[model samples]
Structure formats: C-alpha cells, structure tokens
Target: MIMRRPAVAGQFYPGNENDLRELIKKLAPEHTPSKIPALGVVAPHAGYIYSGRVAAEVYASIEEAPTFVILGPNHYMYGSAVALSTQEWMTPLGNVQVDEDFIDCLPIGIIDKDELAHRSEHSIEVQIPFLQYFFKDFKIVPIALGLQDYDTIKELAGELVKAIEKYDERVVIIASSDFTHYEDVDVAHRKDRALIKTIEQLDVPAFYDELYRINASTCGYGPIGAMMMACRERGAKYGKLLRYATSGDVTGDRQVVGYAGIAVY
Candidate 1:
C-alpha cells in the first residue's frame, strides 16, 4: 500500500473536516473567475490564520479542474534536486493520490523520494486543505525542491513542460513559499514589496540579486526560482502581486515573517 502522510494536519490547518471546510469556504474568494488560468500561482504557506487570505487570492485565480503540481521548499531536509514522495498525502478531508505516472515521466535525476524528508514538512501539507476545498476530484504532484543551480531548475522545468504538453488536463501549478522571515514588520513590508516588484517584472535574476543583497530570508527561494523558470517557459506574460502582509499584522508582534500572494499568467 502507498503510505499516506499527514505531516501538519492539526498545526497548520484544522484537523476536523467540518471545521476545515468552513474555514476554506470563509477564506475563499467570493467571486472566483469562470475562465481557466494558463499559468500557475505562487502562494505563501504560513499558519492558516496568518496567510489564508493571501492564499485565497491565488486559489481564486485558479478556475479549472483539480490536477496541480505543487512545488515547495524542503524546510526539513536537504538533498539533491527535487524530492518526489511516492506516498499519498493525507489531510482531514481525505487522502490525495500522488500522480506517480507524471512523476515517472520526468527526466531521470530530476526526481527522488525521501520519506523522512516529507514526514514532518509543513510547506506542502499546509496547502492541501485549501486544495481539497477548491478541487474535488483532482490529483497532485508534490515536489520538495532542495539546493539546485539555475540551469538544473531550468532543465527540470523544460522537461515538465514537455511531459504535460499533450494532455488537455486542467492543471494548476503552485509554488508554496513565504517571504522574508523574522524581521521588523515595517522593514519586512518594504523589502518584500521590492522583491514583489521584481517578480512582477518577471525578472528572476534581478529578484535573486536583490534578495541576496538585502539578506532576505525567503525559505522557499529554490522552489520560487524553479517556478519562475517553468512559468517563463510556459509563456507566462505577467505576474500580479495579489496580497502582501507580515505575521505581525496578524499577531501584533514587532517581529514577523513576510507573506505574499502572487499569480502568474
């Protein structure tokens, strides 16, 4: 049997199905678009209470079936390129089957499996409940990206584009990330906005340079980099900064983590 992992079910999201359902309903956009989005979305993955509204913006932009390729950073473990879990992902709602077929089609060395790496990782799990709420009958391709060079990421993105090209599947690609962790609220806002501006311009190299210069602590930088490559290859024309805020806004703390919602099209 393919194991179904439930890493952060109770901590990041509600553990109860009814409660989780209600929370998603409340957080989802009031008016979701009827048209499908060609490009993917980049969303923050913090505690739901802190980042749910921002995430809702990304979900609202997705108006199609439930198949998604969720790319997230490896917060718990580190290894080679991207890690693909063979296990199914479990949440309060149910188990979401991993799209092993798609995983197998990716180029060799592009994907690997490390059960321990995903056992407690919160980034990918935090996005599941929201996905379950919006998409009913869908499959997932969960990738935990580790340290990788730009060329490696670009290669993987290119292969993914080719692998999924022929199918007319309603697929939504999501990059799970949070911006600038543990800085003063005001400072985080300014820094994250600058980063967001670079992202809007579709300038990944500039975004990378600026982020490093400022010592921005974006945990999911690798995944974001890979997503940018994939988006560019898939003809993503523009990016929208849907929402931006810090954890301080939610908890009234002087020090906070930055969160931003971005959509690419």
Candidate 2:
C-alpha cells in the first residue's frame, strides 16, 4: 500500500501529534455555533499560524461527513494537469483513508491518479489535521489541479456531483485556497473582499472577472469555482463568509497573504 506522507509537517503545522492537537484546540473556537449541513466550504491553505484559524472556523461551522473531497491547486505542477491521489494520506494526527471506491466513480481521462502531484503539495495536506481533529472516522479524496480554467473546473465539478450521487455516504467538498499573496495589507483586504463577495454570490463569471480586473494572486480560484459549481448543482443556496484575515494580522507586517473561510449550504 502506497502511503502519501506529510510534506509540510513541522513547517505548515506541528510535526508532533500532541503539539498539533494542542494548537488546534486553541485555534478552534471554544464555543462553536450550531453546526450546519454544508454542501461545500472554501478554506485557506497556509501556515497554521497564519491561516489555521480561518480553516478552523470553516470546519467548526460545518457538520462532519463520512467523506470529504478536497480540491487544491497544483502549486508545483508536478504531475498531470488534473491529478487525484488514490493512496492514503499521512499527517501527524494519523493515516487518513482515501476513498478509493468514490475515486473509482470518477473517470481516469479528466482526473488522473497521480501521486506525484500531491507528493509535496501542502494545500490539501494542511486540511487533513483539521478533519482529524473534528471527525474520528472519515475518508478523503484529494484532487490537485494544475490546469484551473473555468471549463476544466466546471467539468470536474460535474464529475464530482455525479460521483457523490452514486456514493452511499454523505460528503462535503472543500476548496483549499489562500488569497492575495504578499501584498500591502490594504490592497490584500480590498482584493480579497471583492473576490469573497463574488464567492458569496456563487457567481463564477463575476468572480473570474473581478479576479482579472484586480489581477488577484489567489492560489486556488479553480478549486473555489469547482466547489461553488458543484454545490450550486446540488441545490445549495449561497455561501457565507465566516471569517477573513491575513498574515499581517498575526505578525503586524505591511505585506500579507489573505485568508478567508466561507461555507456554502
């Protein structure tokens, strides 16, 4: 059995299980509002110190499911344009099962099973611990996208919707992304807020247009688009912005990377 080991342990998050758990306990709110049955969520992928709270807010607000479909950007473009990993993923928390049965439902043509694409990607890897913290028994389907055009995202979303329908367990789609890379805090907020508003509307075209208009350096627009389209197809009403912050908020730096946590239900 191939095991996809943690690539960013100790870097993005703590490598020690105890420390990781402690940190998550602290970052996650003490009082979680009544959780909702969300179809999908958009969470950020960055160092835990920077984006962990945003991720925690999204996770805490949503109800747990038997399976999670995590879509993240291919930062290195290491493998296939659209890559899916069939191997179980390992984090400091433990080995999380990969939903191979669910993966079998997806066609090989569009989303190839390529471990290389996920080998060193932190986007999906960072989200696993949060899942482990909230749910005890669950499986994940991790897909890394190197090609994130609107058409590709839409096609992938359609395939995901079909797969979820055929599967027996409840599932939630997570789009792992971080917005406005390394910019002045004011600029980051302005650009990210515009994109966040567009995301709340579930308007893909306007999101893309706003992204282009500002030339935002968001890392996972494709993943966000896929989640929005898939959730809309599944009858979700809209997205709610639970939290928004940037690295600057943590470190008091002028330049920062924006993070937003949103839930679609």
Enumerate clash totals for all models, in the order shown.
0, 0
TM-score of 1: 0.92
Best by TM-score: 2
Q: Please give the lDDT score for candidate 1.
A: 0.78
lDDT of 2 by residue, 1-265 (tens): 6799999999999999999999998899777888989999999999999999999988888999999999999999999988999898888998999998898877545888899999999999999999999888899999999999999998999899999888888989999999999999999999999999999999988998898999999999999999999999999988999999899989999999999999999
lDDT by residue (tens digit), candidate 1, 114-188: 666676678888887887777678888888876545666676677678656744565567889999888888889
List pairs with backbone clashes in candidate 2.
none
- Judge candidate 2 against the unseen true structure and give its global Cα lDDT, from 0 to 1: 0.93
Clash pairs of candidate 1?
none
Would you list the C-alpha lDDT of every candidate in the order shown?
Answer: 0.78, 0.93
Candidate 2 at residue 169, lDDT? 87
- List candidate 2 stretches off by more than 4 Å: none
Runs in model 1 deviating more than 4 A are 32-38, 78-81, 166-168
